[model samples]
Target: MNAVTNPHILVVDDDPDLRDLLATYLGANGFAVASAGDGAAMWVAFNERLPNAIVLDLMLPGEDGLSLTRALRAKSSVPILMLSARGEELDRVIGLEVGADDYLAKPFGPRELLARLRALLRRSHVLEAESAAAAAPPRFGPFALDTLGHRLLRGGQEVALTSADYELLVALVAHPNRVLSRDTLVDMLRGYERDPFDRSIDNRVTRLRRKIEPEPAAPVFIRTVRGEGYLFNPRGGQP
Candidate 1:
């Protein structure tokens, strides 16, 4: 890890000793590290400033890791990698289902964890660079998403976008009118192998529409393709 590319990572766990250890180890590896002892502390720290990625523990004091992960997924698209005890396969699977990007069982080597975190950050950067601009930006209704700027504007007014929603919308507009399966969208946006059973992609699309659609329930820019997936309608819901 290069000091110049100091990716900030938030470590959330209940154990004070382990939190300190992760901070020291990750910082030594060119990461700007922040640690929290439980879910409440995690929220306080995150609300203050978001990190590039989050390393969450499965066992927290009150709101457990799975619950916290699910809650965070509701609004944020920040990458999450969960840490659990060895033999916690069930916890690992559930973690993924709840929108955790990856999982590592405890008793793991610091080097291995570092490598995994680096890979996750790399993938996220790739996605951020996925949809570059052409001569003219693509338009969906009044909203025009600028891949180069990573910003959205509607009627010359800027639209608020979460990281997840921005990436999801870019993928859709880049392939207008084509039905993209949830798996394809997940793989493209997440920068990882598609978790076939994961519904997080759909969740993201829902959030994106609320920002870009006139009526989120009857979205014109992004249409649900029923069994297939979703397709972008360029004509949009023009009055």
Candidate 2:
């Protein structure tokens, strides 16, 4: 988190212009940037010096981004943000399924990409510090919130969570068993503002339920009020 020590990020994209643009853009934003055109070049840079994170393009030649992601995940826990021209829901879901920390579609704003990278790096740094200090995560509902580690666990096993899911869960758990309004949850997420009739909050709650609740259809942990927002029921299970 030191301004003096710029975080190194490797940008893997086949497009030369995109690579140069990202390198220039990210470099000005206080990040040490490296560029790779394909999977082979990515390894070359990785071997030269492992980066704090990787911005991988999903449509690489021969070995695609997902393949590299699966292969790298088996060896390293370094945070990865997958990029793809395909912005479908299925694509995003698949990317997260293969251990990606986050996903971004093509033609995204430089600022947005920078924000996502910073969040991922920040989470990684926090987890490393917590592990070194032997810190215990907050516990509730048969789950331990590894806030710094950015993953939930129950019965000493890792629980999968995407970046968005983890952030929302953390916000809810911080004020456990309390009714948090949609507006308040939106502020916590820092997401884009929506119309008055927005169901963004409900959508997020549904996603969280599928992951944490034993029965998503009849969710016991995250309960919804008819007119109000959702509440985190600590009755999920004994901590």
* Model 2, residue pairs in steric clash: none
List residue ranges in candidate 1 displaced over 4 A.
1-4, 131-239
Model 2: per-residue Cα lDDT at residue 226: 65
**Candidate 1 clash pair list:** none
lDDT per residue for candidate 1 within 1-239, as digits (tens), equals: 11127888999998888889999999988889888988999999899888899999998889999999999999888889899885467777889999998998888888878867876775565454443454466676677777678789988888989877777877777677789888667656664444558999878888887787788999888999999999988898655
Query: How good is model 1 by TM-score?
Result: 0.56
Under the 3 Å rule for N, CA and C atoms, how many clashes does model 1 have? 0
- The parts of candidate 2 lying over 4 Å away from their true place are 1-4, 135-239
Best-fitting candidate, scored by TM-score: 2
